[model samples]
Target: MTHSRKILVTGADGFIGSHLTEALVRQGHDVKAFVLYNSFNTWGWLDQCAADIRGHFEVFSGDIRDPYGVRKAMEDCDRVLHLAALIAIPYSYHSPDTYVDTNIKGTLNVLQAARDLGVSKLVHTSTSEVYGTARYVPIDEKHPLQGQSPYSASKIGADQMALSFYRSFETPVSIIRPFNTYGPRQSARAIIPTVITQIASGKESIQLGSLHPTRDFNYIEDTVRGFIAMLESSNSIGEEINIGSNYEINIGDTVSMIAELMNRSVNIVSSDDRKRPEKSEVERLWADHSKAKNLLGWEPLYSGTEGLRKGLEKTIEWFTKPENLSRYKADLYNI
Candidate 1:
């Protein structure tokens, strides 16, 4: 991947995508941002990016599900970072069809376009949710995939599709699987943001779901760096790599830590509406990132505790701002 190569980043208007787009621009790459088209003509998080960064991006608003639109965005681009998907777990339960269409079919569109365009490499985004409850600790790339929820199931289909493309058409593809990522610009549907918004909104009791499930979290920056490392590493092609801190902290402990950092002693109230179906919940996830280290030469720069602390502080600062905080409906339960 040369610094001068043209790159197309699908889902560039998203949280991690926006951060990655900014990072790519900062590194002097020519970026074409493939933002989801909407009736309001909104650019999502990319609208909040700094002007200088935005200036460097060639913004293309279209649906990833559209093959023509996807191909148009990939034209003349040397690489494609496909990140567009329907990611909400609860929503996936109610709208599984939408998840299949976006996560699975949308990925197919990107793969076909990348193959047709002869892109040098295609970095396919994946989530650790596909590993389910983790049959063993420190889940690695070879762990059996369990579709605990519709969202993860769709991602499984998409991941297999990318790999199939690589095998059948010799498409250069690298699957980048990131565990729980939280930070500024994250939606309130996520636990970290939900907790932060409730606390920042001056709620005395934090409403949440099950607290015993542990997760391996990676800060937004560290996750973005993992993507770049995978992109630059020639050995990463046709490989699946895990990007995480290799540390696990239960939700209960994470909330306590957040409360401590915010200097607030909020009561925790488990809500039935917030809980996942017993069979659908993932109980544990701890990433084994040895593959990432040995192959891509990538390691998380932030330890679990330090990363959570700094990420929470930055997230708190962002949510405390009236303009930013107002975007969230702290009083309502986000799906």
Candidate 2:
């Protein structure tokens, strides 16, 4: 947790990963970012980061599914922040095998390498989806995990794999489960970005799926700070902590709020194609952050309205740009 120690971040090119990586650099940590390798030589969201922040990173491009590549990336790093995985639920329904490979097997690769290399700590990223629909409000760590979809199922496998490393091999590992983080650089596959991009693109009707499902949304900065707090706390080892705002809002209301924030008027159209299978959709999520506060002294700074307003403002600003808007196909549903 010392700034002097080197940290390796997998999925550094992603939305949360990029923000976390930039924050680490700004705090003067020795950062090595493991971005997914692609022939385009693109660094995804990392490329959108400020030049100064990107300059501080020791970027390594490789696939997390490859054990050899993962080992090479972890070599000499004091800690690992593993966030690489396939996260889209709709896509998982069609290509469950790839989800197994990337989410489960990729996590196995990180665990094996961390165990072998003697990393001080491995902060494995987890999702609220692993909890599925909350049987009770303000779900705690003790909540039962329901694999409602292949994506959540794969994450369950990954979370268990990380815990197994901690129990079996005594690997220094902690699970940071964040709920519905939204912010700039998020992909169109996510609802916030999907709505923002569609509205920014001048769409008159917003196409969406089931709007009744409630979610506990956390801002990017709060979620990133949760990761750091986990890394800094010795008590966090062998623990699974939830990082969320401990608030819930249904999808329809959220869309309305976004529209109000953007000062845009549009019709919300329920698209049959956007709805998830009845059994697979997670109906509600409300986090219990007491464990996180008790263990790591971590608490979210942004209220539900404040976080959504700021995050959406930033995201809308980004998407309003011709170049950024061009990257998204607002007319087409993304997964």
lDDT of 2 by residue, 5-72 (tens): 79999999999999999999999899999999999999988988888895888999999999999998
Per-model CA lDDT versus the true structure: 0.92, 0.92
User: Which residue pairs clash within candidate 2?
Assistant: none
Off by over 4 Å in 1: 1-4
Q: Ten residues in a row with the worst lDDT in model 2?
A: 1-10
After TM-score superposition, what is the CA distance of residue 167 in candidate 2 from its true location, in Å? 0.7
Position 85, candidate 2: lDDT: 91
List the candidate 2 regions with Cα displacement exceeding 4 Å. 1-4
Residue by residue across 40-152, what tens digits does model 1's lDDT show?
88889999998888677899999988889998888879988989988999999888999999999999999998888788989999999999998998999999999999999
After the best TM-score superposition of candidate 1, give how far the Cα of residue 4 lies from its true spot, in angstroms. Answer: 7.8
**Least lDDT summed over 10 consecutive residues: which range in candidate 1?**
1-10
Quote the lDDT for 247 in model 1: 90
